[model samples]
Target: MTFDRKDKDNVTLLNFYLQLLYPRMVEEKMLILLRQGRIGKWFSGIGQEAIAVGSTMAMKSEEYILPMHRNLGVFTSRNVPLTRLMAQWQGKLSGFTKGRDRSFHFGTQEHKIIGMISHLGPQMALADGIALGDLIASKEKATLVFTGEGATSEGDFHEAINVAAVWNLPVIFLIENNGYGLSTPVNEQYKCKNLVDRAIGYGIEGLQVDGNNILAVYDLIDSVATRMRENPRPVLIECLTFRMRGHEEASGTKYVPHELLEEWAKKDPILNFEQYLLEQDILTPDAVAEIKANLKMEIEQEVEAAFNEPEPLAKEEEELKDMYFPYTSDPVSPEGPVKELRYLDAISDGLRIAMQKHTNLVLMGQDIAEYGGAFKITEGFVQEFGKARVRNTPICESAIVGAGLGLSINGFKAVVEMQFADFVSCGFNQIVNNLAKTHYRWGEKADVVVRMPTGAGTGAGPFHSQSNEAWFTKTPGLKVVYPAFPADAKGLLLAAIEDPNPVMYFEHKYLYRSLTGPVPEGFYTMEIGKANVLRQGQQLCIITYGLGVHWALDYLDENPDISATLVDLRSLQPWDKETVSAAVKNTGRALILHEDTLSCGFGAELAAWISEHCFKYLDAPVMRCASSDTAIPMNKALEDGFLAKSRLKHTLNQLLAY
Candidate 1:
């Protein structure tokens, strides 16, 4: 159906006088700042204030709004103070981000406005996450995600919208089709006449509105917001308007036709709205002038205060650093707690206890809440902790994991679960960019735990079964851990939760049900980078971790004549090289074993380390025993036949032979 209704005099203005005049004056002030060199650059919401103001006005307080960078009008209208915003552009500590974010990266968390992701479409995913949060929290509020038509072409936008549609999330996607995405025209970017029609592919309805008319934008978006609360679905709305300014400063906008530019110049949003108000008799020229005068005075004062305000100070920076790190370090714990508990229970109880101890700690994965996770490791948390603390997230791995880093950086201790380790590739970006590098780049820690059910042997086949610890152990600043029994699981998890860095804490799915061991009921601690000397002997040092420790210890027990020191490298990075080095130095002979494939496995690295540092002390060349680089077969016997366990058995016999 053709939605060609364009009612010029129909736009409504409902801002408290302070809020109303503030936006127009701020936009003008920004223009002045750009000319005065007080700010870096400016992107004005000059001709689009109607859409920005009205749509934001239509939203509920609890409802989320993910505004595009151009929504300066909406920001001002919704209580994003002008002085702080000016400081944001000025790169001052008085900025809304306290001097961290970019100039346009404005946010008003108190107003339920999530910060925008500037690369265009990342905010789509964030908006979906906000909706997911609403659903999980059982809040009736919906999410309003704003973007330009240019963002519609981004792959992430499609991915986010598709997922939202499939899940029937309470989300409204608003596209400010302001004729251009900088130099590129909206029509040039996509073949479609309307950006909203793209939602049809994802099984969601689309609507188009005359963005120049504020009432059209307001009433349409408001109805969509209401529909979301009632039916809980994702919808896309295209707002057709013209952008009056160059994309960011006065640069690279030479592409628009002179005729079109002149035509748009005649239809400026504020002036047209003023004329419409005059015609409706709702406002007079004198009243408008008075409003502008009051706004100008208020803005002048706020901007002066913002510019004159002192820096956030060392203490505030220190506090922001802590906000970015959910976990608290324990003076590098004096003792590793491996001796006190079993493996599986170690991780489960460690996480449980950490959640109890840290109010900011939140957990999520498939069936993790009520089911205590698929392994029953987190089984009782829902009852004891409530869904808010221990929640079951939808099976959207990428979206779920991506938010973990963002949430953790924003003061929540997030533990995102990839139900099976093999499926981690689905959320690889979250693990790599969001978690590992975010800390090292900005000198801020993203204290998030990515828990995955790893390893094999339940006949789950290649898809469900994997021992891929080696792949991630290679990444710097990402602490990796795997536990064999209940105690180590709990201990290592406790250490992981408290680490001021990202941790890839993997639990063996096979061992979760059967690997129970005694864990003390009381809360305890463990050192993250230290490994335990499970069994010490004089002949050789066998460095291993995860369930491999179990088989090695058992083998040593049976053959006391084959004396060896077993070291569990609990933390993969900053691994207890001291412990391993000492054991190798004393024993003279060394061997490294693991469950992952032979090629470049963690065992290979250990062997390389021994060869480099302990070559002189070695009784023989360092050896590595690992599984073949083939998919774990469905047949149990064949899988075991191809495993590192058999090679480990052979190595033991050979060491004895020597």
Candidate 2:
């Protein structure tokens, strides 16, 4: 029979093709629910199913994966119930993670489908981390980080792969090279002849496989997996496949010339595989028909099941609400080994201690290994812990972030560095979509920290300086912290490292060396969300955080007559409204201050909240003193003017005016 003999093994090519085709068709069918009037938009991995399915099949159930958005074929082939997949596509309750998971970003730890991060290339670091974990846990499992050729252009690709290669992490960095990253073709995007060739840059093995050959794909992955079990090194395999449809449902191939589409269409993987099977006499014509029929029915049934299942309970939406809420602390002091040092010293010490205890704790970033980080924050880390733990990364922000994500998912506690806070935009997806949303997706854990040098006091100008806390403050399931003093800095940072979610630890560059404080020797735990009253007053509640908290402290000290209650809301995500309300009620006047621009800043959210709940007790309208709505200035005079320089005397005069 032509259908049955397609493989040397029991599997048939016809059956494999159906495994690819039917599930995709069904997933697209579900998308029609929200897309009014049958708008046919899909990132169809149609031409690349053989590779997706074969690689998926070859992977052990225990092995994990970091899939990108277009790998729907692989997801369906893995037996993910169609209904849940549909729920995801439709943004309904029935979707993965109760619809908290974005469309095409589905994950299940049970299924070893670790995640599908929304951003283009951030998953690389997460996969590296998970691989680290697997090694630490001594689990006989490997991780796969799947991306596109376009994604490799992201800094994350280089960072993640380099670290994985250097650390000998058991991860396979697979690039689903579908020729184009959106409208831009691979040829136009880079000078590299092939993505597979990039592995040499990381000093790892690289290969190119025929993505249309399911058996070849399976064999290649199986070989890689086996090699990983022993070598524990990262490798890259570029599957030279073509995407049948546009990048996403929203995109049409209008941008792609018709000739190119038609030419590529002639080489559809399913058709090619089918012809190969027919030539080999692997599957008979009659048998192929039966398999297709069965696959179609199975896909339809899964869709029906997904549609019939009750949507994730809308009334119980509160269950998914903890994305930003901080956990309460234990009454007893968290007992970890304590150390006495300066605040930055404590941060450095914590890293030293943690890495000393856990060999798997890897610290990577720009100039972190030898040059002691751009901040010199990681000074002597490499000398103390060696290159494995303190790694100097390339100048690729996306690559470094993606590598950190991979390391974390691989079971390494990665402290990723972005040379400056202004550069965080380069690694934004790693912080937001992937690392932040990972825990909710796997329903497991991804404990990692992303540290950046933030704020602007030096003459670094507009480009080199920024405090983008407000940018990340709006993202759920992420904790953003800025410390006013050294003790809080060390304690809170340690807390973030142990936390199961991703954290953005912003350390102000101005205060790093200037605002030194004696941190007690040994380990001490600081509760994350609980706001502390630095100075108690009855006249007005000066609600502030981060660099502003330090300014407020100095202001309050100078103007004791104002009788201001200074509250530092340490953790911005699970922000302390209760603390703010109590302070406002006690003082009857509230002022919100921050270093960010005035327009839609974090303070704006706090002010609106006060207007809703604490407005009745306001003795004065909430006053805000923040940077004017403009980019930070390059000139010293304009720069000073643009910033919200504190004047307690000026603010008090206003309250008196009211």
Candidate 3:
């Protein structure tokens, strides 16, 4: 590789020199910290500093930057203070995340930079959402996202890139092809001639650059930045570089040939940049030495100060505040007699009322724009809210949810609709791993709601009709809510919009029109994590939610002889344990029911809890009734038999007989 001899002024030359020195100084100090047992682990960007520094330097100050763990140069270039970085690595309270997470896993609203999670591929998809939100607002800004060659193998990588392409989001996908994914070589990870070539299929521009040449990398990105800002198009730029160090401190490169490592070390990004500056007479030899010495001193002082700071104390009560949804109530409620409304109409009214009240609320889903969603729940929403707020996304479930997460982090609450509740499996990675873990991992707020159209009655078959609430209930860091009435449905949807955490709001498809009742006309919020007692009784307790709530109510109404207290467990995760336990202890018997499958369902957890806590109070074994352990068939007869009302009636009769 050769350098282009051109003077782009003193400011540019000076910044290039500093970028080269910053990462080199930090990585060397990181090795010392590891030896002293001050930091736990380190992933050095040693030979690839140029790619991080060069690409980021081209971005505007306000443009969002999403970087993976290895991009140390990008962090420093973005003006992330050395003290905060040092404190974070040392696990001190003065760190960015207040010691919630260790190293590079922290973000701040002020900097407009989202700290990278361990999942490298998903961040690319998230960047698309952030960029999409900006595009919707007509903001002239671009998003810069970084990943490695190995991450391209992940499903999220393709999903995000495809969405960006289809939507023409102003996002720059920078792939740092560092030759290897930990111990595995590039050949084993991808079969393409070059990673950038894959952009041909995405209908985006592609380019490959010599990542070791800082000047060339900067020039290529700088030329495209202005164009991307104007047109807002997704572009792929592949930087060919190598990680001179092992994956982490302890992970030795035994799999890499010694000759290969030696060859790459000779072309180190920082060392090459330094030589270029010297040969071009941009700086004298003494000036180069002085810059390195000053950077080292600054880094050492930062480490010393950060190590002296006190570590953050974890208060159980205070920390628990961030664990679940904070307590809040609705201000707008009906003063006069409430009007009767259909359950589906109530949901639409709730969305309209919330959108009118809160400016930060936005809705995204497939066919949600002109089509108003699959069931017309959002009919005419586009005309009322405009295309910007009411977005029709591509058929990418993972991208839809992942982008919603990005919007949440950026101070906007996203109401994401899964076309079918069962289709959420396509974006399972974002739902369970990313959305559920963001708050717990770094104490960052994920204020987003995933609206699931769940349950069966329309004979939509296995793929469309499924009660997947059990899947989310089993995962931590999520609030699951299922409303059986129009009033609760409207109130809870409003409450979820105002929540500061992620919520899984399951709207049963069957109850959308069949179950109608008097609903408040104005904005109101039902308290989350509480159960509603529909009917009080002394014979037994029926713990149910969603469609099961209706079944339990219908059975008791018809069989007037059996008297039982029906508890609607609206909140499945942090369920109203106090209410259910008290009701069960009073009745001396319990029957847990749900629309989900019988085996390994959420009801199993409830049954176990009742047995453990209300054990002595039990008059008979705590029984659980749910849909048969089979896929919901397309035939109405088969589906009804699968979750038959008669079967539920028989289960209640048997429990009453016991």
Candidate 4:
């Protein structure tokens, strides 16, 4: 693995020459496939081989890589079979994602290379989490992540590097500055002389190298790898190269100036490396020709074999329901010693119990370690579980979510906390795009729990106080749960932690202390996507979740005249539609309520469902009562007006009258 001066130049030449051949051959074959209409679209990394090949060669075998679309060289150099790569391009079942994805969006768990999504920036942030996990576990291997110049323009780039720098994570931000962000030129991307200079802002070492020179890249990486083995600091490396072809085959070279293409063609990495081997007397003309011929034949054979491989069989709609979510069944209610605990205490207890039972569970959040989180939910966790398990991260929401995905990929369940549910927007892409879709796309479960401290009863203004569960409820391939009672908080969270898919656990901020109840003592998990009946009546059905359930209960308690059944929808995404429907039909009237703004809240969906399914059974139209469509104000009066329990009472009275 050592590429030192002691090694013969001929040895290095042969190694580099072969590394360059695979991607170039693949690129050529992809172009052929594109013409024949065998593949959907093709992205050629024709000139950018040196960066992936050299850097991968310098790293250890066990190290993980989060590659972008233009990193076929990385896949090739890291021993990914050519047949599998070709099969992936053809969207066959033999592919890593089993025809779930096309193009470069496929990777295998065995290889430790996560499949790249179209959003290039989140993977870079994800690499930070992978590196952090290894670091905490005291692993020596470092993570190398590839990103383009355009991706650096994203906030994820800054958030990722900032976390790496602050935490001294063992991750390398390898920026392939290929002189353009797709059609846009590098001149318009940023004003900085070199992309590496931006690394100084994050207080990390920055280096720019001739990306065409494999030896230079290898040496710099080798040195950095040695230093990082001891120091564990992030490094920003800008590989100055050019995209020899159009962005993709269909994109064409039309937008690219003829002069620029002509200039870059002369500096082609593979051709240049081949010439260097010949000039150094390391490879004869016949040897070079033979190698090229052998590679061409091998690639052609693999591509042909991949084409013959059967495509993935189409799954039935019912069978595909739990492909991403397996645990759709009801929960087994707990029967054990009961402890009267606050909702927050119950949550902490759940975490403590889960971690104590499962060694693989790790808790991460901003100010969660010593500061014990913003709401002190994890006040004593760091001392009990140690800092490595109860990790304190930088204020990067995206990185936290992205890192959780990485951890889940590596066989660890991460319990990541968002300071406030409203702040989840910062990591929205990672949550909705990466984490939510991973299971559905590749049958890869992202076993992560996002503990959201949500709801608007607190006067923490628009940023800190908000109910955003409805946002994730609309998303596919995600488990959304909002526990009302302390027992449900403890039980549902325990279930979420053990679940194979990504679960969004929304803990109402107001309910943390106010909604105290007798929580079970031992570890138990309530069924997800199931509703609980707090009180049963016949005249009307009030269906609600989170704090809304309590508001509905209060209205009935004070009135005593309202004969309404109270149903708490603990799980929103895969809601208890059957249970709620039965209750609505039995009562002959339905009311959906929540704390999120009324316009597009979970109430809308519930109301729609009741109206459609129980139209004939109902005595009156399905009605909804939720906060007004406006930001929660800091003033107590305005905040109360925005989400007052009296509103629920008035709305229920009108529904009864109707």
Q: Please, what's the RMSD in Å of model 3? A: 2.2
lDDT of 4 by residue, 1-658 (tens): 1123436467766987798787888888788778888777888788888888988888887888888888887888888998988777777878877777787675577777776899888898788888887887788868889899998999999999998898798998899989877799988888888899999899999999888777778888878887887889999999988887778877877778889888888877777767766676888899978988998999898889998887777877843674475665556567778989999999989999999998878898989999999989999888888988898888889998998988887767899999988889999999999888887777678899999999887788989988888889888888899999999999999999989788999999998878789988987888888899888898899898888888887778888987888999899978998999889888998888888888988888888888888899999988888888998898888999998464887787788889
Per-model CA lDDT versus the true structure: 0.73, 0.73, 0.86, 0.85
lDDT-best of 2 and 4: 4
Model 3 misplaced regions, further than 4 Å: 5-7, 35-38, 310-314, 324-327, 644-646
For every candidate, C-alpha RMSD to the true structure in Å = 6.5, 4.3, 2.2, 2.5
Q: Please, what is the TM-score per model?
A: 0.72, 0.84, 0.94, 0.95
- Assess the local accuracy of residue 29 in candidate 3 as a C-alpha lDDT between 0 and 100: 92
| CA lDDT, candidate 3, residue 91 | 75
lDDT of 1: 0.73
Better of 2 and 3 by lDDT: 3
Tell me how far candidate 1 lies from the true structure as C-alpha RMSD in angstroms: 6.5
Residue 182: error of model 4 in Å? 1.4
Query: What TM value does model 4 have?
Result: 0.95
Among the numbered candidates, top lDDT falls to 3
Candidate 2, residue 654: the lDDT equals: 89
Which digits, one per residue and each the tens of the lDDT, describe model 1 over residues 12-49?
34242234346767878778877888777777777777
What is the per-residue lDDT of model 3 for residues 336-424, given as tens digits with 9 covering 90 to 100? Answer: 56988888999999999888987778899999989999989999999998887888988889988999988887667899999899999
